[model samples]
Target: MSGHGFHVHGPHDHELEHAAHGNDDFASRIAVMTAIMATVGALFGYEGGATQNDAAMFKNEAAIKKTEAANQWNFYQSKSSKQNLAELAMVLPGADAEKYKAKVARYESEKEAIKKDAEKLEAESKEWEEKSENALHQHHRWAQAMTAVQIAISLAAITLLTKKKWLQYASYGVAGIGVALAGLAWFHI
Candidate 1:
């Protein structure tokens, strides 16, 4: 049952044996190529995931800045409105009462508009952070899956090159499937 240490067809067996050696070399080459691809895919996936995480962090920082700016604007507007209302009440008295009332009303309206804008900016900051975090999670998942696939492919390639019948039986077609998945992940990254 072994191809080595025995010959049944004399010179023809020698030719067939030489051909099998060539096949073995071809299989080894394939295995090496598969390993290279797997390694590259794993590296790319890892880096892509890390980059996504950095982007998420940046988004969070931006969100924090926006919220802080909005809060500061609101505080400033509230103080200014109160001061203006007090000054107008004292300075106008009975002579320009209606004019003071109109001026105060406009100031109140402007303050309310600024308050709405600050709220809107705060909401937008939260939304941006959430979106960035989601993208980071997706990239992390993709990287993990690709790493597992690459390991599987490397194992399969080793098995194929070694020409162990048991390994072959256990690993046939695995390298192909792993490579395909790796390629898909690479494209995503």
Candidate 2:
């Protein structure tokens, strides 16, 4: 019976052991969670940046198309004016030039409308830019949270390994790397 009796640690020893175990568990959990959060942050950042790039590209394409359409309209108006002049010279030499001038004025009005439409599209594109910035800001916050978790985990690990030289050194190495990664995230990378 004496030999079968369980070995019991004193209250202080038990408490220290418990604290070490708790720190170890907390550190491992936080490390895993930090990895997950970091991955999520990276994905969100990429998606946000891509959306912004797409919006800018769409805006450029729309502007180019609008310009081309306006130029084509101008070309048509110029050709019509030339045809009117030729007809007047051959069929009615004394016809007033104001009729041909009126066609030019209509084309000018159409150009102004096209310009306004392009401006409206650009304004909407600017709104999209703001949305993209918002998304990026959200991603930034997520990254900061993830980094904090990583640092917490590392500190917990360091505390847990305080009594074991080998484990302490290993934890230190791991914590160093985690800290470097967290720094990179915070600084935007």
Candidate 3:
């Protein structure tokens, strides 16, 4: 007891003080490693979600393009039917042959335009489908990266609990794989 006051310290004060100062090197390393892995995992998870959304958007665009192409094709088919009717009118008795010829020509021209537009839309649809596929592939990569990082964090926790040096190394290895996967995802590989 001091003259001014009595300050009683608990028996585990030394251990508590050591922890407060981060004196246990293994524990500090595991803590830092766990924090880093968690951050990386979160980032990977966010990227996976974003990529999934992108894939859905691209797929929707593909579907819209396909519908537009189908409409154009329907218009082309209608023009073909009109042109067939006009050709038949040219040969029918008591019909305006010149007007029918003009009608046929106009329908053919319109059909050509519609065909081109339909083909263009079909190509756009295919492109959108390819984009959607690529986005989905990237999303998978991000998800895999997130999974690896999560595994690493779990390993780090186990290392802290058991004080196993080998588990720490394993955690580091898994974390490296997670980072590599993240890089691959960034490159869209």
Kindly list the per-residue Cα lDDT of model 2 for residues 1-189, writing each as its tens digit: 347886766769987787667656545654564466456445545544554565566556656655655665565566556656654554465766577567556655665665566566556656655555554554454445445445544554555546444554454455455445445545545
lDDT of each: 0.64, 0.55, 0.95
Q: Which one wins on lDDT?
A: 3
- Candidate achieving the largest TM-score: 3
Clashes by residue pair, model 1? none
Q: For candidate 3, lDDT tens digit of each residue in 22-97?
A: 6688899899889988988999999999999999999999999999999999999999999999999999999999
Per-residue error for 82 in candidate 3, Å, reads 0.8
Higher-TM-score candidate among 1 and 2? 1
- Stretches > 4 Å off in candidate 2: 1-96, 163-189
Which regions of candidate 1 are displaced past 4 Å? 1-22, 29-36, 39-54, 57-61, 68-100, 157-189
Q: Candidate 3: deviation at residue 118, Å?
A: 0.4
C-alpha positional error of residue 150 in candidate 2 after TM-score superposition, expressed in Å: 0.8
lDDT of 1 by residue, 70-146 (tens): 78586757857675875568575465776666766777777777777777777777777766776665566556656
- Per model, how many backbone clashes are there? 0, 0, 0
Better of 1 and 3 by TM-score: 3
